[model samples]
Target: MNKPVLDINDFPSKTQLITLSFQHMFAMFGSTILVPQLVGLSPAIALLTSGIATIIFLFITQFKVPAYLGSSFAFITPILIATNFGENPGNAMIGAMAVGITYSLVSLVIWKAGYKWLMRLLPPIVVGPVIMVIGLALSGTAVDMAMNVNDEYSFLHFTAALVTLFAAIVFTVYFKNILSAMPILLGLIIGYIYSAIIGIIDFTAVKEAKWFAMPDFLLPGIHYEFNITSSILLAMVPIVLVTISEHIGHQLVLGKVVNRNYIKDPGLHRSIFADGLGTFVSALLGGPPKTTYGENIGVLAITRVYSVYVIFGAAVLAILFAFFGKAMALIQTIPTAVLGGISILLFGIIASSGLRMLVENKIDFGKNRNLVISSVILVIGIGGAALRFSETFAIEGMALAAIVGVILNLILPGREIVQDEDEIN
Candidate 1:
């Protein structure tokens, strides 16, 4: 099949450029919107912040990386656990800002010591399994969402969810070209059409919603009180650690795909700094933490359009969409079943990527230290082991697992895999 365009330097025809941009937009649609929905933040806020984030990310990186910023799935579980405010996610955003600062600090460390020290402190043995737990721990949430996260509409919801899941799988597996990169978008469309046909959608909100209304902007410090907690910080920061590792991988992948040494050109420290700054900005605006979208990267791989300009076009589209209240309201009407169906794949991908990290690194299970470290991290994270600080603050789930893993890796004897090659990244 003919692709739209390929190569970064190739001047794309106007029609091809617009098509490629929209493809990137839909490719990122499901996960980007889902993150805020999962954590009780505004989807409009997420979209708007992501647009602003991508622009800022581009500025910080000197427009070197052709990537779009979107809501990160890593913070979902922690946000739910850390913030008690149901509708107002002020505390959660504060916790998210802490995660970004943690990234900034890590960036500083990487600048001083280079990225190798990070591998030494948290190697694949610890980092890989913790990331796996991040995804696996959320399996229950996906199931609950698919079932409306409640008992209501059990039969109808489950059926709709099944249809959505099946459609996503079919689109992903059967459509092997550029289309394969868009299962989330396709499944969502299928869910929307199905729900409409079944009369499961309530359009009143959409009907009453203004087409040109602006997103409900949230200012964490000014509009809402910024609450901080050590425990919540602890719970959320580990996910930052995960994204740091992912940052390395993403840079490597993007560099390879674009045939440019991004790690050297933009430099890892600068890239991470930009990512941290973008994430912090997102949190300030009451959106989820921002991260580079792998979906857009996949689209780049398919279309062969490596132009950062194309990505900027997608960012503009996202901002426009964010300001369109009726469109966002319509999207909100999507059945929980639809989100549930997509979450299953999205979360599983996160877990599987971590497992792939271990496998690609050829982690030797025979090493008792490696075995023990991974075991502790996975069990604690998956089991929701909480070390409480007070009534409102507690370190549990991924954070607790990460702390334990680092301590165990440091103290345990016979764990000298620090000098391993960077073959995995």
Candidate 2:
């Protein structure tokens, strides 16, 4: 099916602009908030960062690109591995800031060396498996949360989770229009309703919440260390590469959506630099790392509204919500079972993206180099193998897998045959 034709230059009245802006906001609401719930981060911070990041993205793209930055799924597992939620939660974000800085460096290289260099350094073969590992690693965590009721298995909790998962899947695959765009949110609604019915959701926080409260911001970059046992900063450093690959891919998709060669115009350098700065700034404020949102793009494709102003309008609304204590409190009331259901699907999709990357690039698995690299990375990553050097500094998980894949790709001789050069070109 073809998407409705949208004229990017089409100007709208204030009323239409407001309506479109709300639509944009609702479309991204589900996934944007989900990241914080899964990773033990503040939902308010997530909302606030996304809004600020989108505004920054606009500035970097010269107000020409219509992209909104939101909490990234790519960093979910890396963060989980990096921090223990209670003990060094801020450290994960500190590592995230480092990742963001790397993004800026990549932009500088692209400005001089070209994007093909990035493609070779982090190709589909390497990126594909690393992405898969990010998702697979967290699968167990999702399942455990769904089954456990306050750290013990409970049938009611399991049922609530199963129902929520089913609803999310159904909405994502069968529903159309606005409902289709908000599967995670809709699914969570169903899950929460059921969870409440079963006495799983605790609304005490919401009840105790005042009608108005200030947004208490948690700043980062205080205590930073580079180590293995307790250093989330080191664990999360490698995932930055995965996010960059995601950034490049998203820019190409955005170019297609806007019908402009953003890869050339504002250039990948500028686009990534914006995202890097967005992440660095957001992480410093204890917010999750930001990336270009796919949910917003889906909205663009659905409504055929490509106005940059509408997205800006949505960003403003997000910032407003972050300030609204009641809104953030309500988001906190969401049940663990509901979050588990969404995580299961969300994490799987992240993994599936890696597989799709390999297939789309037509990477030949028959070649010894390709097969060996992919297999080793997957086993090390998903199987949870790590190489620890010291108590404080070690490499493992997807990070280790990524480093190993890059080394193997570089050291391994002979190039696998490509079915089509134009696909890569």
Q: lDDT per residue, candidate 1, 29-127, as tens digits?
A: 777888877777889988888888888888888887898888888888888876653555777878788878877888888778777678777778888
CA lDDT of each candidate? 0.82, 0.82
Residue 154 C-alpha lDDT in model 1:
83
- Give one digit per residue, the lDDT tens place, for model 2 in 1-425: 35534455566679978888888887788888999888888888888889999999998889878898999987877787778654667777777788788889989998987777677778889999999988898899889878886789888888988888999899889977867877888888889888889887778888888776766566643444433244565677777778888987887787777676777778889999999999988887888899998888888877778888889889999888888877788888887877888888888888898999999988898898889999999999988887887877678778888889988988899854332323532
lDDT of 1 at 117: 72
Per-model tally of clashing residue pairs: 0, 4
TM of each candidate vs. truth: 0.94, 0.93
In candidate 2, stretches whose alpha carbon ends up further than 4 angstroms from where it belongs are: 1-6, 221-232, 416-425
